[model samples]
Target: MALMITDECINCDVCEPECPNGAISQGDETYVIDPALCTECVGHYETSQCVEVCPVDCIVKDPSHDESEDDLRAKFERIAGN
Candidate 1:
């Protein structure tokens, strides 16, 4: 599943650069992750970098975009063009 940023986000900006997929962006109040671009770092890293860098632990999975690992890998490959 794709990850999302919760209201608990302090807008610390730490998680933005950590996201290898470039899915995280500045939202109205907090950083938000684009579900379409989010692959949980499956093809890039062992874990979600945004969640890993978020100090407040605000990054969580988006149940709405629930997808299997194969789907995530496809998304990653599509974004990476490989």
Candidate 2:
């Protein structure tokens, strides 16, 4: 599943660079994660980098974009053309 930034996000900008997929970006107020490009760091790391770096713990699973491990891997490969 892709990770999401909740309203609790302080817009610290700490988690933006941590995302390997480059899915996290600044929104109007708080930062946001792009579900289409997000892979939850599946092929890049053991866990979601955004979640690992978020100070406010605002990063959480995006229920609307729920995906399985296999699906995440496929998405990764598709984007990366691997």
Candidate 3:
């Protein structure tokens, strides 16, 4: 499943670089995760890197972009051009 940054994000700028898929960005208000580019770090790491680095625990699953493990892997492969 894709992840999202909640309003609680403090713009700590910690999670953005940790995203393997380069899905996280600085939005108008806070960091936002691009669902199309997000793969929950399936192909890069065992867990979501952004979540692991986030200090406020504001990153959470994006319900509107729910996807299974296989789907996430596929996304990773596709986005990575592998």
lDDT, model 2, position 52: 84
lDDT of 2 by residue, 1-82 (tens): 8888999999888998898889999998899999999999988999888888878898999899989999999999998999
Per-residue C-alpha lDDT of model 1 across residues 48-73, encoded as one tens digit per residue? 88888888998999999999999999
- The stretch of ten residues in a row with the least summed lDDT in candidate 2 is 47-56
Steric overlap count per candidate: 0, 0, 0
Query: Candidate 1: TM-score?
Result: 0.96
The true-versus-predicted C-alpha distance at residue 2 of model 3, in Å, is 0.4
Residue 27, model 2: lDDT of 94
Whole-model lDDT, candidate 2? Answer: 0.90
Clashing pairs in 2: none
- For every candidate structure, what is the RMSD over all alpha carbons to the true structure, in angstroms? 0.7, 0.7, 0.6
Number of the top candidate by lDDT?
3
Per-model TM values vs. the true structure: 0.96, 0.96, 0.97
User: Model 1, which residues run further than 4 Å from truth?
Assistant: none
